[model samples]
Target chain A: MSQDQKRDAIIEAALKRFAHFGVAKTTMSEIGADLAISKASLYYYFPDKINLYAAVLLHIIHEAEQAYGPLVDQEPDPFKAMDALLKHRTEFIIKYYNVISFIRSKHDIPEELKPVFGSVHASELSRMRKMVEKGVASGRFRVADVADMGSLLFECLEGLRMMYLEQASSFFPTPEQFHNLLKREQQLSQIFFNGLTV
Target chain B: MSQDQKRDAIIEAALKRFAHFGVAKTTMSEIGADLAISKASLYYYFPDKINLYAAVLLHIIHEAEQAYGPLVDQEPDPFKAMDALLKHRTEFIIKYYNVISFIRSKHDIPEELKPVFGSVHASELSRMRKMVEKGVASGRFRVADVADMGSLLFECLEGLRMMYLEQASSFFPTPEQFHNLLKREQQLSQIFFNGLTV
Candidate 1:
């Protein structure tokens, strides 16, 4: 196998393990055993556990960006791009919430991984901001401030996702949980549309 | 001091300790020492660390109810009461987010504490639902599904609070820090008013 291919395989395996077992419990040896590689061979690619862990993180961030990277070409109507972006983000959150959580939770990410994540998520943030700003420029969005309005809209969705994660216990009182959540999402969307429509 | 007074004192100390230091690092001996009571005396009040921990949790729940409990009163024209309730909840979250986290992270809280938190939060939930229902009935709220509307509203606020708490590294974006939050609150209120208005 090619060296980078083998490394990427290990990174993917380690991410799945980290997602299920969390960082503390997932052993480097276990990651190697899963790949049918010896611990020594794994160490040859990545120097230590933290290095391997960061590789897993960078891999996910890379994958997430590939899945829903920021808008660059969707300029004629940014809202269309935004609509697609929101849907893309929602799907990513649902499928990779663990990866999302891992990214969200820590400040200890290695410097090597930060540029990748910062560039991707930060670009996505600005891309969405620009889309809102564009709508405002064209007399579409009517909010008092474009950035505040955009942040509020994004946080509303991210907040719902965070609540869903935190209230995974039965304590989450929503009836027909999916229906209830979707209804909430629509309501927030409706409110935004109402407040922001020009 | 009377037995109840001393017991309540101990519970209060334990909760403060738990809130800041978390459950793992919090020691029974430390709680006892904080109260200036002997370990034997502490045991007399509660059988084990778990029991004392539960007692501490229940006390906080009781305080939470005391702090935000009255908004659920059955009365005509409860909008004022609800506004007060939401404001109280906002303050509660701001001041006690850590305490909430402490209680929330526990998997097996004492039986006594469970109902205290569940019933109180459930009552608050019902009150939120009730406020929307009452608003709708009185033609003061939007004509949407009252419960879903209420969940959406709370989820937005809750989501913001949780995000602020979870992503402490990232600051909320703007002059609307407090204003924009209040703005969203106002927007939700406006929607409710529109939905319920004749």
Candidate 2:
């Protein structure tokens, strides 16, 4: 494999280990072994565990963007695009809540790594902004500050994610319960969009 | 003082101590001493520290309801009432985030005491339901399930509280920063209300 391909392999392997065993317990050797590479070779790509973890998070973001990017581009209705985006985002969150919670609890993530997470959030906000702008342009949505409306919608979704994570232990113990919660969230998005459109 | 008056004093004193020093640190004796009552007498009203803590929480809920009840009832516009309610709630959460966070992390709050918290949340949801129904009745809002929309709004506020607490250390280090967050939350509520109203 080429150098870049090897690095990508390392990240892919590390992500699975980290997700399964959590960050603290997952060792570089295990990640390297999964890729049939030496620990030294892994270090050549990532330098340290934190770097590898950040890379894994970035990879997750890239994957999510890839999944939703086409839907955002092709959906003619802005509201429907938003609904798809939020549903996709929530599904991703539910699937990865354990890893996400672990990362959130760990305060040791480097300041430099923050932008990796921030950029993903920024990208999501920009998508929402574009949707609102499109709705306005098409005379479907009211004329308001596109940025503020986009942000409002983004915060609502953030709130939903936070609530879901908080209640995951007790309120949403069953998959059926979680599925119901998502349905309610979809209904909420519809109401919010209805309020925006003429 | 009358027996009821004495019990009220104990609850009031306990709330102050609990709010200031947190539940684990506050002692029943200190609460009694603050009220110049015997520890036995204090226990007469609240059998244990847990009971006293629960009572204090109930008191806070009652105080909040009293503060906002008039506004919810007297406001002519349902959207305005919701805005007032959310703003009031966010302000309360900001003031009590530390206390609330403490209670949440402990996770030992008794099952019986669950009703105290649940009732407050239910009351808030019911208020939101009433507002949505009012808006729809007046042709101000699009027809939607009132209960679901109310719960959605309530969840959004709950999410805001969670996010604020999570970001308190980094995103909101100063009172001014927290104030700006509240202002942004208010703006979001306005947009949400605008979407609901015709």
Candidate 3:
């Protein structure tokens, strides 16, 4: 295999392993075994276990960024664009639950590796900023302080996403009443627009 | 020490050790050592490590219940009752961050002890429900679905408390803000109450 192919294999294998076991307990040997590569070959592609872990995380974040990147579009139809972006996000959560969990719990990750992670993180906020600007411009969202709104909205959505992942079986909103797959996407969209409105 | 005193000491030691180092790593003998008791003597009070862990959790929960029980009265004024209950809960969090964190994480808590744990959980919910009923009765609050509103308001508060705990340094919200602990709380609260009338 080519060097790049080997590196890619190592990252994909490591993500699968790390998602299940977490980075602290996952070992170089286990990662190599998952890739069906010799430990020596694994070391050749990535200098160390930490480096390999960073690559895996960066790949996961990059993929997520691509999934939610549409939110940054300067759409004439702001609400529709938002609807699409958030729908995309909810879909991603349902599909890539493990990757999202890893991203959420990345505090244990080294500061040096955050640059790789920052690429995706920056896009999320930028996307929100664009969405808020569009909403304000179109006179649909009557809110000041995009900076605060963007940050708070991100955290609220993050909380909802995490809560859904953590306690889906226990007390998840029923689609018929609260929200299901289709209805959750709808509720989240409506909640953001209406926003504690009387 | 007498048997009851020794048991309390052991449970206290478990709380201290578990809070510092987490549950699985802290051995039963380590707690016994902290309590100045022998392993056999510790076993005399609680048959096993899990049982001892359960005792520690129950003790903390009981302590909190004792502290907050009297505040949960069915008051003539809902707002007053809610204000008092939340104040009591807020104090408990400030005073016993460790024990609350331990309970929140479900650290060392066994499956069978869940029902006992749940009663404590129900009491907390009952207080929120009372507040919602008062809001509806007073007509000061918009009433669409009181049950959902009660739960969502509680979740928002829970989310706020957790954010304050986890990211307090990142976003240092002060208490005087009225709606949220953040600087924007006052404005946010006004917007929530009065709507976008401006």
Candidate 4:
């Protein structure tokens, strides 16, 4: 394989190991063994485990951003666009449950990952801003403070998304529980959207 | 002191110790010592540590119910009543942060405390129902499902209240963080209340 292809192969193998065993438990040698690469060869591509972990996270974030960007940017109806975005977010969170949990295990995000995470946050907020601005322009939303409204709506939806995670007996929610969460989100958002109407 | 008054004193003493040290660490002997009573005397009023813990929790719950019951029932304006109730709730949660954290440590609430907790839940939901029903009757609010809307609004406010607790670096919020939480609640509620209006 070419150098770039080898690096991609290593990242793909590391992602599964990191996701399953967590960062602390998963060793670099195991990751190398999974890819049939020598430890020295793995070290050539990434200097350390933290760097490999970052690569895996970046891979996940890039995939999600690619999926989310078009959904938020392209939808004609602002409310529909937001609904779609939130729905996709719910899936993304669940798909990356272990990875997210590992990141959240610490009180703060790691220094190395902060910039990437911050950029993701900034872009999400901007997308939210765009959708609300669209709504206001269309005369569909009568918002007093567009920025505050957009973020408050985001917070409210985020809270709904986290409800199951905090309250459930299991580490992850059952399918039925996930359905209930989305149902509650829909119900709450209907009232919230109505409040924003002209 | 009379028997009932002495029982009350013991509960009062236990509350402070339990709130500060948690139920597991706060011994029955220490609680009795706080009140200048013998361990036998303390057990005369309550059977064991669990029983005393229950009594202490009941005492706190009763005090909160008394404080909250009037605010929800007597306020003429539904939105104002809810606002007042939520503000009071934020204070209550902060004050009992440790106690509540202890309760949440368990996957399910202890079987012994379930009835009392259930009653409190039932009353809170009923009060919410009453406030929305009053709004609907007065034509101040427009709601399709009164029961569902009241609970949904309650959940939304609850989510906002928990925002600081879940995100804070410290176990309990600092004063400034507390202020910000209430501020965000007011902002979010304004939009939510508007959605419910005629």
Candidate 5:
């Protein structure tokens, strides 16, 4: 395999192990053994366990971006685009539920992952802004300040997630809890979007 | 003083000490010292420090209720009432910030305060329901499910607060952070209420 392909292979292997056993319990040796690669090669690629974990998170983010980035143009209707985006986000979060659970705890966030998370946050905000602006351009949304409204909407949705996160007893939320959160998001999003509708 | 007055006095004294020094540092002896009452008298009123802390939280809730209860009728407009209620809620949070900070940390919640906090939470939801119902009755709010919307709004506001609380470096939020939270609440609240308005 090419160098880039080998790195992707390593990340894929590490993601499964980390998701199943959690970051702390899953070690580099186990990951290397899973891929039939030597520990020296794994270390050469990732340097450490934290670096591999950060790469996994970054990989998921890239996957989510690829899945949802075209939603604005594909959907045409801004309202529909936003709804689809949120649905994609929900699915992405649940798909990587166990991996995401590490960040929810707040204490386990690795230093290398902070910038990855920060960039991801900024991109999410920018996406929301673009959606809101699209709606305004289409004369469907009656927003005064598109950027401000976008940030407010994003924060409200985040608050909804945080509400459920706080209520869950375990790091990973139950499916039912995730269901309740999605319902709240839909309900809240409907009302919020209606307010913006002209 | 009568028994009731004595208990209130003890709760009042403990509030000041706990707010300034936090629950970990403040002791029953210091509370009694603040009130010039003996430790025995303090114990008579409150079985232990935990009980006293719970009472203090309850006291503040009662104070907030008394301060904001009439806004639904007093403001004459549902939108205005909610705005005033949210404003009062913000002030109440900032006013008793240090004490409330204890709850934000999550791990420090006293066992005795669980029921008290639960009841306080239920009452807050009930109050929100009442306001939304009043708006619907006045033909101002076009809500299909009054109870659901009320709960959704309350949860959204809470999410806003939690967002900032999670961002804070210390147990208590700084003034600027609180200001930003209030701005987000107002912005989000306006959109939410507009969506509900007829």
Candidate 6:
């Protein structure tokens, strides 16, 4: 296998272990053993566990970008683009909530990895801004400030996501129920968007 | 002093100490000492520190309700009422973020106090619903579901509040910058309300 392929293999193995046992307990040797590689090889690829963990997060982010990036960029209708983006975001959160929760609880996360989160957020914000700009260019949205409106819309979506995560047990007891909650939230967003467009 | 006055005095003293030293470190004895009361007297009013802490949170909630209740109930314009409520909420958060942060970090908070948070949230949600209903009735809002829209609006405000609290030190490094951020948020809400009313 190529060197890059070996590294990707290691990250894929680490992601599963980290998800199952969590970051605190997952070790380099276990990952190395899973890949039938030496610990030295693993160290060569990622000097420490933190670097591996960050790579796992970045991997998820890249997957999301690949999946949703085109929808934001190529959609003809800005509203539809935003709706797709929000739905994609919700799915991403549900799929990786465990990793997200781990990240939230881990205070010792490296500062270098902090920018990954910020960059992801900035990327999303810029996408929303582009959608707003598209809406205005097409005379579909009456937003006075595309950047501010985009940021607000993104923040509102984030707020809904946070509320859902926080109250998942009580408010959304099952997967179907959670899906319904997301649908309702999306409808609510639709109404807000309609208000903007009108 | 009247019984209610004494309880208020105790809550005030506890709030100060809780703000200064946090819930884990603040003791009933110290609070009683500050108020020139016996530990037993403190216990008479509040069975434990957790109970006392709950009272402190409840006191803050009550003060907020008293301050903003009229605006929600008596305002002639639904949009204006919501605007006022959102602005008031931002101020309340800025004023008491330290206490809110302490409460958020205290995992061992009593179950009884959990309802305090719920009640505050529910009260706010209900107020938002009323405003939406009023707007719909007055032909000022084009909402299909008042409750859902109201819930969404409240969630957006909450999300903004959470973002502000989390990023206060970074995105909003100074008070002036934070205030500007809030103002921009308010304008975003205004655009949303305009969209609804139109």
DockQ of each: 0.32, 0.50, 0.11, 0.52, 0.81, 0.54
Error of 4 at B150 (Å): 2.9
Give the per-residue lDDT of model 5 (tens digit) for B74-102.
66576788778777877888888778777
Ranking by lDDT: 5, 4, 6, 2, 1, 3
Q: Of the pair 2 and 3, which is ahead by lDDT? A: 2
lDDT of 6 by residue, A39-130 (tens): 88899999998888889999989998899888778986877876787778778867765565565421334676888877887987788678
Please name the candidate that would achieve the greatest DockQ relative to the true structure: 5
Q: Candidate 1 has which clashing residue pairs, if any?
A: B141-B192, B141-B195, B141-B196, B142-B192, B142-B195, B142-B196, B143-B195
Using DockQ as the yardstick, the better of models 1 and 4 is 4
Model 2, B3: alpha-carbon shift in Å? 4.2
Model 1 Cα lDDT, one tens digit per residue, B1-198: 999899888888888887788766888899998978899998999888777766665676667667667544555464565666656655655454454444433244456567665766566567667776777777655555678766666677667655554453443233234444555655545544443455
lDDT of 3 by residue, B1-198 (tens): 777887788888888887677666788889888877788988898888767777777787788777666665656455456555656655654454444344443323467567766776676566666666765676666656767655544444444444443344333233332234432323222333233111
lDDT of each: 0.64, 0.73, 0.60, 0.76, 0.81, 0.74
Per-residue lDDT for A1-198 in model 2, tens only?
A: 999999888888887877777777888888888888877888899888888878888888788889888887678788678778767876776665545545543234487578887888788778878877878888898855888877777777666766765676433234455576677667656666776778
What tens-digit string does per-residue lDDT give for candidate 5 at A121-144?
898788778878878888889888
Give a tens-digit lDDT track for model 6, residues B1-198: 888898889999999988777667888889999999988878889999878878888888789889987876888688687678767876876677556555442233458788887788788788878877888888878887788878777776766665554465323234464576678567656765776884
TM-score of chain A of each: 0.63, 0.82, 0.63, 0.79, 0.90, 0.81
Residue range with the least summed lDDT across 10 consecutive positions in model 5 chain B: B101-110
Distance from true location, Cα of B63 in model 4, Å: 1.8
In every candidate, what fraction of the native interface contacts is reproduced?
Answer: 0.52, 0.65, 0.02, 0.63, 0.80, 0.63
Lowest summed lDDT across 10 adjacent residues in model 6 chain A is found at A168-177
Candidate 1 achieves a global lDDT of: 0.64
Please tell me which predicted candidate would have the highest lDDT against the true structure.
5
What's candidate 4's DockQ score? 0.52
In the predicted model 4, the residue pairs found to clash are: A195-B195
Mark the regions of model 4 whose C-alpha exceeds 4 Å error after superposition. A1-4, A14-34, A43-54, A91-122, B1-3, B15-34, B44-54, B91-123
TM per candidate: 0.61, 0.77, 0.57, 0.78, 0.91, 0.80
Measured on C-alpha atoms, candidate 6 has an lDDT of 0.74
The superposed Cα distance between candidate 3 and the true structure at residue B76, in angstroms, equals: 8.0
Please report the candidate that would top TM-score against the real structure.
Answer: 5
Clashes of each: 7, 1, 2, 1, 0, 1
